[model samples]
Target: MTVRSIVKFPNPLLRAVAQPVELFDDDLQALASDLIDTMRAAPGIGITAPHIGILKRLVVIQLPSAAKPAIYVNPSVVQASTEMIRHEEGSVSMPGVTDDIERHARIRVRYQDLDGNERFEDAEGLLAVCHQHEIDQLDGLFWTHRLTRLKRDRLIKRYGKLIRAS
Candidate 1:
């Protein structure tokens, strides 16, 4: 496993939809481990395979309160709550900027485990937000898409400045 570099913002691949992970083998597991390593190195709580330029439907999330990271493959939101919550959200691809994006307060996601076992999970709070956010990434929807035009523009501008300064 390796700590793969994150694909930066505006990379066409970040906006490209990820294909479903058909094989649940050692290679997939290695990719998952690499994703975990990459996310931790990026110091992000969540990341998708697309973040590392691998267009596979895989995501890794390790919330501070969790004992370990959760890996989801081909995950999709099966259900969502009527209630909504506004949380500060960002992406490993777009560092140094975040915005309060409203998302469902609770969600039920259907996905596959490392062994290709189909499973479902009910998530709330930050967990729910992470699931939705990553799923959106799988569908080629970057986090900035949730922001208003003005906010998105400003955030992108700030991120551009950060990149230039670096």
Candidate 2:
């Protein structure tokens, strides 16, 4: 297991739609393992294939205090609560930038586990929020998409300035 580099925001890969895993093989499993290691090293709850420059539908997430991580291959939300919760969230892609976003308080997700077995589970609170956030990355979406247009514009400009500085 090893930590992998996270592709930063505004990178073409982050916007590129990812391809689905056609077959579950050793290589795919290794990628998953690497993703887990990277997420752990990041000390973060989630990481996606696109974040690592792999245009494949893959994501890993482990909440704080969770015993182990969970891998989601082509994961999607199957159910979501009508009630919503607003939480402050940040991402490695946009370092130092945090935003309050509204998301479903509870959600049921369907995805393949690390072993490639199909799994279905319900998640709430931070877990559900993290799941949705990572899954959005798979779809080439970001938490900023949920922000107000003015805030989104401000972020884009801020990121642009940061990019210019770097």
**Would you list the C-alpha lDDT of every candidate in the order shown?**
0.96, 0.85
Give lDDT tens digits, candidate 1, residues 1-166.
Answer: 7999899999999999999999989999999999999999999999999999999999999999889999999999999999999999999999889999999999999999999999999999999999999999999999999999999999999999999999
Specify the poorest-scoring 10-residue window by lDDT in model 1: 90-99
lDDT of 2 at 2: 79
lDDT of 1: 0.96
C-alpha RMSD of candidate 2? 1.8
Task: Please write out the lDDT profile of model 2 over residues 1-166, one tens digit for every residue.
Answer: 8788988877777777788777788888999999999877766778888888898989888887788887888898999999999888877777666778899999999988656788998999999999888888888887788899999889888877877888
Best prediction by lDDT: 1
Candidate 2 accuracy as TM-score: 0.91
**Best-performing candidate as measured by TM-score:** 1
Error of 2 at 123 (Å): 0.5
**TM match of model 1 to true structure:** 0.99
Error of 2 at 81 (Å): 0.9
